[model samples]
Target: MRVSANLGFLYADQPVTGRIASAARDGFDAVEFHWPYDVPPEQLRAALTAGGIQGVSINTRRGNLDAGDFGLAAVPGREDEARAGIAEAVDYAARAGLSAVHVMAGRAEGEAAGRIFVENLRFACEQAERHGITMLIEPLNLRDVPGYFLTGTDHARRIVAAVGHPTLRIMYDVYHMQIMQGDHVRTLQGLGDLVGHIQIASVPDRTEPDRGEVDIRWLLDQIAYSGLVGAEYHPTRAPGDWLRDFRSSS
Candidate 1:
């Protein structure tokens, strides 16, 4: 499994454009970005090229970090907003030469939201195809995101299945899944072909792999055997030290 770091959280003290550089300097295989539209595509591309790093994924958009707009992919009466978001993401990804974007199920929705959700997904998927990018929809946990409609692996899987398109897939985040649901391994196995990308952070503390309750190495091994790309996170300390545990033990 190739590793990637989410620049959203880590490298907070540095310029957002420096994210890819830091990830490369720290030995990350690739890096992912969250809500990076604010940064110009050419600048981002330049950073990626200079850092000698590849981008794993980038989010379509959000309501800024403070507003907690994880994404409005399934919200009711937001087709235009969703479409605009998709278009922007596709254009950005096309320019950046990125492979995927995380489609989010933002707010908790009522029955009406469900209908709108399907429509929004189909719309987004259709848009994603035009730019050769895959839309990876992520399900946030109720504890962290409380009321996010896409909260479970099964639901995410079902939604992707319903979309039934090549470009739409699930962003299987182990962190949220472990927090919202306990069975990570089972879900990964069950979800199977639908999982387009995977992310991980230890449960309870959202910290480095060794410090958390989940067995990070074991999970990586499982995901590796399954042939999935494992995106990255920042360690509170130097990454070499953190990853040393993995290398020596292996």
Candidate 2:
């Protein structure tokens, strides 16, 4: 199974560019990013080329942390900001040679928030299609991110159906789903093509997959997903050490 290192969590000790090199050295097939807007696209592209690995995906910018904005897409009265973030993400992903962008749904609720999310996603999909990029929406666990708009697979699926756009799809994260719901294998099999990306981390503690309650290797073997599986875990030690151990065990 091919794996992508999630730069946001793994390799927290290094800079973004350094993390790319570290991921390459650790035998990762690719890398994924979260809020990498601070790094210029050209610089990131060069780093990826030098590391000899591809950048598979990145997240749209989080609006304002101080204001407690986790994202902008699903928030009512923030359509312009959300669309701008979508445009920026699409353009950056194109320039950085990334294939997908995960659009974050901010802290929100009620019917109006849902309506705004769907409309913003439609606009995002339209922009992404022009560049041959896919738009992803992930269901974050409310415990980790309270008030996060998207919090369950079924809800995310409904949103995708509402958007009815080819480029828009779900990012199924094992850790979050395991917290909100169990039966990972069945859920993944059921989602099928609606899933555009997959991410994994240990449940509850959010540690390396090998050290968690879940049988990650078994889970991997049961699934027939042909895409890169993101290792989005918080490492207890050097990430390379964890990867080496995981490789040997697998």
Candidate 3:
């Protein structure tokens, strides 16, 4: 699989824009980041162009995390706020030439939250499709974010099915899935074409894949043969050294 450097995790020590160049220097195929609104879109676009790398994905703004908001997409009574965020994310991703956008489902819970999640995703997909970009929903494990609305592959699948939009799909994250459920191969096989984007990191401690319980190399090979993959791990050491092992794959 072609690996995209998750700039948000990979180059935490560098300026946001510099992470693009760092990824290029480390021989990454592409790059993805969590939030880019702090920097001008023009600047980010320029960095991507200069680095000669594609920007594969970005996350919608996680409204007021310090106030306990992880995302607004699934929160009831916040449909307008969610839609507005989607609009901004779509506009930025389209203008920046990104391939996908991950719509985070915040701390909302229960039946009402589920309904809101589906509707917001449908609306977001419709909006993103107008710009030829895909919208993704990922299931974050509770260990990392205890109150995250989306937390299992099956739950995410049901939501995607309910939305039934061509542009709306699952952002399958192996790390999260492995935490919530153990059957990776079968789970991935069951999902099939519903997976729009893939992210990976070592479990227990979100670190480089090298020393993890997960056989990341085999997983990478599986993804390479099947679909797209993004390296979204926190480096345990210097970024340069951590990336060296992945350079040859790129």
RMSD of every prediction: 2.1, 1.1, 1.7
lDDT of 1 at 146: 71
lDDT score, candidate 3: 0.86
Say which prediction, candidate 2 or candidate 3, comes out ahead on TM-score. 2
Q: In model 3, which regions exceed 4 Å deviation?
A: 223-226, 247-250
Q: What would the per-residue lDDT of candidate 1 be over residues 46-75, giving only the tens digit for each residue?
A: 898888888767886764458666677777
For candidate 3, write residues 37-75 as lDDT tens digits.
898777888999999998988999999867888899999
lDDT of 1 at 81: 82
lDDT of 2 by residue, 1-250 (tens): 7889999998877899999999999889999999788889989999999999989999988899999999999999999999999999999999998999999999999999999999999999999999999999999998989999999999999999999999998999999998888788998888888989988888779998886678888887887788888999988887778778877887
- Model 1 stretches astray by more than 4 angstroms: 64-68, 223-234
Better of 1 and 2 by lDDT: 2
TM-score on alpha carbons, each prediction: 0.91, 0.97, 0.95
| Candidate 2 stretches greater than 4 Å from native | none
Clash count, one per candidate: 2, 0, 2
Rank by TM-score, descending? 2, 3, 1
